[model samples]
Target chain A: MTVFYVITKFLTFPGAITKALFEHIMCKVLKLPVEDTRCLRTDEMCGHIEHELVERPVAGFWLCFIPGLLNFLLGMSLSLFGVINVYCLGNYTGFIQNNALLSNLFASALTGNANLVSTVNFLLPILFLWLGFSMFVNMAPLPEDALMMKEQYKNLNGFLKVLFAPSYFVMRIGAPLERYGVTFILFAVIAVVLAIL
Target chain B: MDNENKNEELFDEASAIEEIEENDQPDVSVEPEQPEQEQPMEPETEQSVEDETVERLNAMGDEIDAEDLGGIPVTPPDDDSVDEETESELCVMCGEKPADKSFGEDYDLCADCRKRLVKAPISFASILFFILIIGVCFFGFLLSASQLSTLQAVSDAYDQAGSNHLYSAIKSLSSAGNIGWKTAKKAVSLYNDSGYLSGIASMVDAYFYDASASSDTKLTWADKVGKGNLNAPWNKDVKKIYSDYNTAMDAYEKYYAYFSEYDEQLYYGEIAVKDVPYDELIQKYETAKQTETESAGLAFISYCEWYLANMCEKGLETELQYMKAVQEACPDFTWLYLTKLTELQISAGEYEAAEANCKKMLQINADDYYGEYFRAMILRRQGKYDEAIAKMDAVIADYENNGFYYAYYEAGINAFLKNDIKQALSYIKVCYEGEYLNYNTANFYALLNKLDNNEEEYQAALDMISSNQAQLSPTVEKYLKKQITAEEMFNGVGNPFEQPAAESEAAE
Candidate 1:
């Protein structure tokens, strides 16, 4: 399990770096005492923070939600931008359809029909694909963040638990799913499908 | 290094558990001898309490294992043992603050120090990975942009040359040309400035005596192309198109010139009909047929030759034979030759041969309507009216969405031949409503009306056939002008083989 974790971390190294940096900044901003900030060993850090700061469960919740939510939204936006630009804008500007678009990029040049606009359109999507995939693989919160949120919810009254239910569920489900490398697999499949399309 | 540290931690944890177990043994035995102590306990009770504490410590070890501690084993400090040394322990890292027990007593680091201890420096692999992505993206974008702009320049040159075949060939050759070839771009620009492509077109038209209009433009375009200074590979493809074009043009001129002189001298009683150079004429036809450059002109010339031969009652032996020879020589003209051969066979009443040719057309292109259409006509001529009607129905069903209204007209004729007036009228109405007004369709309208005994509409149909003279072929045009009787114009004529003028022009 640890070996799989390490491999997934390497696969998502860029996302891991961003995650570590974001958590570090969040810890300082919340004035919470830090436990660990290792990129590869991200799982070991968040679990201990709530143990040291028993009264700061709200800060723990924010620490998890903000970074995870931000990464998820950023990943979605970047990938969607690439997809819509290639398919929609490509069609609107009289470029080809998805099946023919890749070949057209080279064929247009071979047939002396390519232009500056087409070149820009071709390269932008590739850059976006890389950035979006990196972000998507690390969008889940750490398992400890979900544990902290669960503990915090138990202490809250009925209305507060209800208010926090969705976040708790997402964190609970997302953490182990991310830890077991499901997020990485999902992102890889999506990238392959998108590239083929 | 990380594995070594984890091994050390595990080893230290195991030794600590051993020490506690050993100390409990001596203390358990000495409990019976310590009755004088302030709060002494019975031996069994003391041992049981010590046993419970060890169990608690072991349970904490399991809990630590449940958490992802990066293989760092930890033990919670024993608050029950309130010794001075226990109170005096401080953080191993940043030695100012007391060691936080969040990671237990075995991990003597404070929270901040624990985080600091595990903080990793960026690996060399990750740094290289990011740099690779950035570099590939930068260079890929740069190269594509450069190639696209170069291609755009080539397209611009084609546009300036008015996109004719000569410029198109040059553009295709230079599209993949090396970026360093400034001479290729310059040559296209020079051709455009000198009005070279238009000059070439004028020279071709003048050579063919097209429309008998003299072109004022000189043939200097040939000289310009020769002096283009293009690289050898680039020059090769462009020269081939020009050479093939000239070869076809010369053949057309020679073939027509000989026929014109033969016609003139025969009219003046200067030569016998047997003196015709048929072998030389066939040679010229074969030469033009080789390049397939002036295909429309060749088809027209072949049609004229067949018409003249048929007028002289020598069509089957002369022109039909020539067409068969051309078919064997030129694969590109197979469809044209096949269609012409089928029509000639039908006119000569060679039903079996015509049917075989129709089957060959369908074998070549199954979707070709010509195959089914000609076969339907052959069936009609064979007096198999029912079978002909079914064939036409199949054609109509297959091409109904494509607006092939001519099939409805043929089906109407088949229905009429079978004496099914009601079915015939319905089919004819579909063609008429579709506005497919031609001499055949108009004549069918008149016949159907006469069969119904409606003299007024029959006369109207006849007047419409005459009124739509411009829509008719030359033979029907003569009938409309009262030069031929209706029977003479209509007898032995199904639909003419020639398409309407607009469609014929588009086909050419």
Candidate 2:
């Protein structure tokens, strides 16, 4: 599990860095004693910070919740942009016989005759896809943090638990999947399929 | 995203945590060492370890509330004092801190060392890496936007040209500067193929702009565009255009090759013009009519077949019959064929039929000068010289500025037929000075000078006629050799074997 976690962090190094940055900022904001901030670790969190978090459970909850939520949203937005760029706006197979899609897009773009729209359509999606993939793979919190979150859920009132049930379930499931390198595998499969198409 | 699960058993956090709690000890069990008389411990080291433990515990206790500690039992300060005298070992994670708490009978760790076992700290390098990723994305966005704007401009330019706005399109293209293959491909996608064959035409024209481009090069480019874009999958009309274009090009190529071979044979004096393989050339273009009846290529090939028939002394009646069939089948594509057909009808003395064909030509293109010019010639042939002169005058006036020099030349012929010598010279002078001068101009100039008794000019005109010996057909060349008289040649009676009709007295 530790090797898989290390491999996951290696594969999604950008996301790992982003996770560390968010964790550090969260620690500082919550007044927790941050003992270490190294991104690549067998364990995602330090013992002192984890202990401090368990004692101040609300702070710990915020620490896990905010970064996870932001990463999830960022990943989703970037993925959507990538999809639109690949399937809707740009053409990877321009030299192929059925250059119909690009031809049609070209026609529509000319109909509007707006340079700004064409410029945007041409540039942003590729970068968005690259960044989005890393963000998506790292969206899951560390396995221990997930366990801590699950433990904290027991202390929440019925209304709050119901409100956070879906997100909590995602984080719960995503943790083990990320730890075991499942997220990277899924991303690889999807990216390969999309590229082929 | 599954992968090697070899390390799964090595780091089972849930099991390890359960084991730690069940055993009531830290990860490593501690055994207090017996003091040796030879290696006595420094008093200051033990005091500092105790002081550090006290400070760490005090700080941890101040930060977390007792109720929020959840399942973990925090050892109170009074309990720590009770166990201090009995416990003498240092911390398991960090050897510097003294053992302050015990999980099981054999295990112990300081408060700071306990937290270190669970999670690790994030680093500043990770933040710098995040910034680097963002920087790359930002720079890539700017570069792509800059490159794509140029491509977009090129696309818009091509689209403008497709719409027939060539001037503005050229302006846009020039301003966009040179484009690479990648940009060119992108620009091609943006081009609007406005269904007028404009996009394809522009490509073909640009490719064939090199004067040295061979017919095979032309054919290859044509085939590529014809099969690729013209026959594109979606549009039905475009597919049909592709089929028609390919059929026409194939037929045209065969016909052109056959004629070029025939021309070579004739030039080498190996074959007579009468043996020019008229049937073979006819066969080539005639086959194109089977699949396509309305394409410009079909129309052009039909005209070529008619010209070959006329030049080879094949039966004019046969060609006129085929032309009529073509016009019947594809009236929309028969402009050149109809024009030739009208000329043949006029020569055959079918004045009413010739006039009707002229009207049909007018319907195809309202501004067609041939329609009016032919009608005037038909009027002159019918001996309605006044009416012909008036119509020819209108044609000349309406189209003279547009370089319709043929109209003026025809008006000169009408004047000669009307016995108006002064008017004939004036109108013929326009033909003499006009850019439309060719064999017809030279022939008419000879006849005009003969009638006016200008002997010097008459000889000069005859020299002009004889000078085009290589271009003239065998039947026409006999007239230059004096085998036939000026009257016989000018009145369409040059063939010695055919008897001249009384109506042939009129000038051709």
Candidate 3:
């Protein structure tokens, strides 16, 4: 119950007391079932936990040593593709020559530097691919057990059903903060440094 | 208990479909139903149950139609009343009510399971509304931010585009009407900063008359111009002065013609003295002066003075002897006496005295509009443009509205010189709209059109003036011929367009 309160507060209010209030409201007003109310712990949650446990040390060492190797390569590819689009559009007869940046880029392309072109082309594609991959990795799955628990507490009141489903999903994702603590901490430090710099 | 639950679920499912169908029907109007003959169906077939339900609904529809025709209004049955009317109305989700439960309490779901069911749709709707509100607020914030940023960027671009030295000079000069000493100094400074010497000198000369300038600044300016130190040090390129001079000359000619007629006609009485047979009159006056001392000699002196004054006042001094002979003959001529007074006042630079003489001449004969106009001119020379205009306005208002047309033209030129383009344009437009056509009016129209940036209209007006020069009054023609050059009247006034190459050189 305490864990449930902690997880719900983290999901709903970002504080311990507010989370308790939120859970109390859900139990009283929404009439969500008590057994289903437990915030799913990381140990009991879905996802490749065993794989993460095995891979963490190795992944952490590579992440620390490389420092934005993947991101830099990806960003470069995206920039190259943007350059290529500009170049092709500039050379097209129907396109206006008034756009200075595209004209300058085309002029640079005509200067016959293969290394510059190759570098631009390589970086842009890598950037888009990394962005797509990261987005797919972050999303949590719906828990079937929570859905079953909700079914047992079914009532005719329309408002309660709407509130429980999304709240249940939020509590489920928030339950695993301790297990993924190191990864989140690394992300936070990197984000802050990038923002300031 | 399970079998009863299954039965109740089926009953609720059946009833829910019926309710949904009832909700889907249009409520406004329906056709009256005709009764159909009964038909039997096989008892064991699946079709028989469907057939019974359809027949029962048709019978209910007919009953509703009968109620409508009897002028009875239809009211939907209340939920509680429906429950009371039927022993076991099916649950919306199940096929039958629970056997052990009352209709009002735990009837939809069995009593043991009443706490289990949750309203998922209502909770989902509430969550959707919350998310929508947040999303809209976020979107609105983003839109407002982007619009503000765009407006700021556009304003910054506009400021950048207008910030150059030339634009600054233009803005300052335009704001300071008839550039004062400080404004001229600022212009020179701006020119020095931008290294545009020719433009600086021309702009200073155009806006500020050094001769008429304030004492201190005039001395400084003269010293600068005298030593050839006024120009920007780095800029050596000289702009073509002839074109600007020609344009100013043309404007002056146009301005001259409009008022020159009045100048000529106003002083015509002095010129009319030339037509008088002065030699015979001078002989008679001299003979009379010898006969009498006070009356005849004084009259002879007055006659000689009048003749000489007329010649001098008309700037026809070469015919002075002829005027002297007329004075020697006409000893007691009043015209001679008044002309002598006019000459004395003019020579002494007492224009008010001259104006008083003109008034005396008008009192002797009141038909002289020209005399009145000349008095107004004296008033103008005394730096009373407003009073002069008021007098002219009265003359014009008394006669035809176009009577003091020249006054309007002069007023327009004065306004233009003062850099009041809007007032100048208004006054000039009044003259143009009037029946009077003179060189001044033509040039004024041209100047007005040029200021308005309507080149085609300006050219057309110039063309009209040139083509119809013959139709102008003789006074207008004579004045225009003297005031405006043939080249100015024919060729469109103002400088011909020079290539941008010269401007670029100046800019450098």
The candidate scoring highest on lDDT is: 2
Best model number under DockQ? 2
CA-lDDT, candidates in order: 0.55, 0.57, 0.40
Off by over 4 Å in 2: A1-5, A33-36, A42-61, A69-132, A154-166, B1-122, B144-281, B287-508
Model 1, residue B463: displacement in angstroms? Answer: 3.4
- What TM-score describes the B chain of model 1? 0.43
Q: Could you say which candidate leads in TM-score?
A: 1
TM-score of each: 0.42, 0.39, 0.21
Worst 10 residues of 3 chain A by lDDT: A87-96
- The local distance difference test score of model 3 is 0.40
User: In candidate 3, how many Å is residue B406 off?
Assistant: 3.5
TM-score of the first chain of model 2: 0.71
lDDT of 2 by residue, A144-186 (tens): 7778888888898999889988888888898788777788889
Of the pair 1 and 2, which is ahead by lDDT? 2
**RMSD in Å for all candidates:** 20.4, 19.6, 33.3
Candidates sorted by lDDT, descending order?
2, 1, 3
- Candidate 1: regions farther than 4 A off: A1-93, A96-197, B1-319, B346-366, B400-402, B470-508
- Model 2 over residues B1-508: C-alpha lDDT tens digits? 1112212221232344446566887755221111311145655545443335434644664433333433443333345665665545677567778775554444456667755543345555766776776665554444344445445666777676566544345446546543422232223322222222234334333321232334554443323321223222333343344344445556556555657777677666677787886776788767866775445555556656766776676676877876776566556544336777887787677889998988876654444677888888777766677787788788777652637776777777677766686787777767766676665665566556766878898778666645654222333345546686533443351232232221111112
DockQ for each candidate? 0.06, 0.08, 0.02
| Model 3 ranges off by over 4 Å | A1-197, B1-348, B365-367, B429-435, B452-457, B468-508
Of the two candidates 1 and 2, the one with more favorable TM-score, higher being better, is 1
Model 3: DockQ score: 0.02
